[model samples]
Target: MSLPPAFLDELRARVPLAPVVGRRVKLTRAGREWKGCCPFHNEKTPSFYVNDDKGFYHCFGCGAHGDVIRFLTEQEGMGFIDAVKQLAAQAGMEVPSESPEARARAEVADTLQSLAGRAAEWFQAQLRSTAGAEARAYLDRRGVSATMIKDFALGFSPESRTALKTALKDAGEDKLVEAGLLGRSDDGQTYDRFRGRLMFPIRDRRGRVVGFGGRALGDIQPKYLNSADGPLFDKGRLLYNLDRAGPVAHKSGRLVVVEGYMDVIGVAQAGIAELVAPLGTAMTETQLALAWRQVDEPILCFDGDGAGQRAALRACLRALPLLAPGKSLRIATLPPGEDPDDLVKRGGAPAFEVVLDAALPLSEYLWRSETEGQDTATPERRAAVRQRLKAHADAIADPSVRALYAADFNARFDALYFARPERPPRQAFVRGARYVAPLAGASPALRSRGPGARTASGEVTALLAGLLTHPGLADRHGEALAALPMSDPRQAELRDAILSALALSPDLESDALNADLVRRGVGGLADATLKSNRLRFSFTRRDAAADATARDFGMMVDTIAARTRIELELETATARFRSSLEDSDFERQQALLAERVEIDSAMMRLAESLRDD
Candidate 1:
């Protein structure tokens, strides 16, 4: 027995064609469709194409063409009934046991679909009539072109509530109401659900009109109204302009997802054909899945304002759990107070193209979204940042991707907290050092005079011990301390301990701070490391104020880090210069030579920033 047409349509919609063929053929996305070597014949320029939107697989080489059912029967060698049963089970539909009631329901749905399509045509006809002059003018004012109006099937609903009810009276009010074209009030009076509004018809994958979205003609409370979910229309499962966009997206290999119907039309007007929009709601998982069926990573272009940013962030979080190896989202945030439509209108497609080219990857956007405007100077605040990153990273469902996300966040956090900036040299000590003063007239050529370029483990040990003796210096030099390079494992441990102690007890005395370090398991290493240096401490006088010691400690640490940076750059340049000469890369060699001079100038400036005590 033949199955019901409604059940077959639902099955085709539910069980996307890509996965069914992907089981046997190794399909890779090519444009808006999946491409692979033909499963029927032995040739491999990849002429076989499977389009999820069209629900079919076609091969240009072998001339094999079929929908999901035909592909299964041909490739899997299954009988017709067996193939239908299998696809029905995968689509979550029970094979229909032929019954009178089931056939009647299918007939009713067919009638509703037919009524909705007719309603869309009637609305478009009304839009061209004199009654639609206001709607036509509104579209013109919005810069919607004549071609776009006809292409998108832009239309209008008449002001009279009973006009549609009266015109389609022959079709029966029950079917009209069921199709979402008319509404029946509590008093049993019938009227049009959409009146005096410009209409955009929403189509299913097969390019059949399933519903309508109406935009208010004037200043109204709700700017847009979508068709109610019925046997034919479910907003969450459908996207506007998707049917037209699918083929174009296959050629462009890009799918731009905007926020509104007009935005989609505007983008297309600006010469971007591979685009779609949600039906007056934030993107749903089903919608995202549909988008992924078209492209590996769809670009999400949102307004650059706070609300748009929040919406993008929400999409990011929602997508984390659903992310697979090849599927993700790219975030393109427009400049503040602008959206895709406004940007395209002002600067044209190229301007919007620049924004698309610079769109951030999902990972980068997530990092910026969580870290932007956040103060990571204090240890507590830094910890909070780390926790937020962890929460986001942990939410990713893919095990490998989750671990990589965590590692990436940790690397960024370390760079933010432990990378050192350049500093001035330590002050030379007297028999009883009291107050160290800044150096004067320090120059680049006089490198040894500032910090002596001597970063032996012993000198670094002394610098760290000095900071420990004056934990208050951690607060005074918080910026520098936060950036201190912790190449040595012991230094890294001590750095954490110092920051933790200061964060918890900013007013702790030196003795108490030292005890806290010991309790934290770094005090013993600190003593041993400092004693091993065997160098005289320069600014440890009893009369020295905490500020004096902080100043001395900061200058010394910065000077060390700065000198080390310059020397490393010099060495890198020398190696590159030698390699470039070997490869006869004169341009790169010349660039390196110029870079060395710039490095020398930077070193000189660093030395000049310091002064003698």
Candidate 2:
């Protein structure tokens, strides 16, 4: 049974070809297509190739060729009807029944599509005629060449309300309205929808004219008007120039999304063919998915104005939930007061190329959007920034990508606000000088003196030694490490050095980290710290099991951090009790003292555990 061409087209658009072929053939991405060994014939090297943009597969080895349906019919040995049925099920489309009503509906769709093509032809003819003088002048003034006019099938609608209506009178007013070529008023008066405007034909993925976008010429309120949603057109789901841009984008490994048709036309005229535009709206999720099907990261080259930036942000937010590994967007901002068309027209494609080259990754753009020009001086303000960043990170649906984003944002936050303060130069350390570890079971009287009684410097040394032994620990517990208070200037310097190295390369091995630290003049500091403390703490020893060392190192860090917090609280409480001789202040001080004692006891237990391990 024959099916409507439009139905077949929709089916093809809905079902991606790569995944269909991939179920049978192990395919690897090769530029714009998937390549695999030919299943038609035994071959060691991959000769079969699938191009999703073009929706076809070919094999040089066996001289095999077919589309998705044909691939199943021939390769999998299924009948044509069975293949269509299975694909229709996958696409969630029911097969049109071979009934009179279905046939009539199909006929009407075909007729409307035919009328749209005819309307385009009439518009093109009118563009070259006297009726289109104003539109022609407008195009010429905008630097649109005649060749571009012909190539893009650009035309002009006459100023007469009934111009298109009269030209396509035989198509019937009802059919014309359904095709979005004519609009019917509430009083039942029918008229042309687009009048006296430079016309841009909007095509489907198969390059069939489905709708039109018109730029008003003379003092029109809505400067740009698109064809009303009809049987064939849904602006939110369709992108202008996608049909032509897909193949070009695939071949070049680049797809640029501009603001409007003029920007797309201007950029394409400059010989950059891989470009598209949303249909008179901020980019919708469907449009983004369509672009992603062609390229991994499509560049959004919006105008540099506030509106354009807002559009970019909306697109970014829309895409966050849909983002996956290797699937994302890059955003390019044109100069202030310039759109892509203006930029390209001014400095040629090179200027536009520079903007594209300098395009920021979506993550960077998001970061700047939240943090740029915002005051992060106070802890509360910085925390607010962090909460906003976390909200964005959590918007990502994929767990792995979400985790990575959260980690990256947290790292940036710490780097921006909690960066280790500079410390004095390390005092000269004599080689082979053994520094004793603080006693694990100190008396309550000594412990009351806070971390001072615990030899805070020795604990800091051990922590640094553990980090030097296993640089990976720094990556795992960066925030914790950054929060650790180091009184010794030498240890603080070494800790900062480690963090800086990890910031550069989070996966840096122990040897590379040590070498980097050594080059930064912290090698002796690390050596001195390790030699003095490694003998006391087993986790600092390079021979210890990594998992066990990490656990012990984390416990040691928590214990030290807790002790530091209690010491600060104790100091604050002491001042408050002295300043206000009130009972509440005294109770607060006493409570803090009790908490400090507990923390000190925990630190002692941690130290004893590390020594025993």
When summed lDDT is taken over every stretch of 10 residues in candidate 2, the lowest stretch is 434-443
TM-score of 2: 0.58
Off by over 4 Å in 1: 1-105, 420-613
Worst 10 residues of 1 by lDDT: 434-443
Q: CA lDDT of each candidate?
A: 0.74, 0.80
Off by over 4 Å in 2: 1-106, 422-613
- Tell me each candidate's TM-score: 0.56, 0.58
> How far is 36's C-alpha from truth in model 1 (Å)?
13
Candidate 2 lDDT over residue span 497-581, tens digit each:
7876665456788888888889878899877877788436766777888888889888888887777766655554444333334
Q: What is the lDDT of residue 117 in candidate 1?
A: 83
lDDT of 1 by residue, 403-460 (tens): 5576577667766776667677544333253211112212243333222243445546
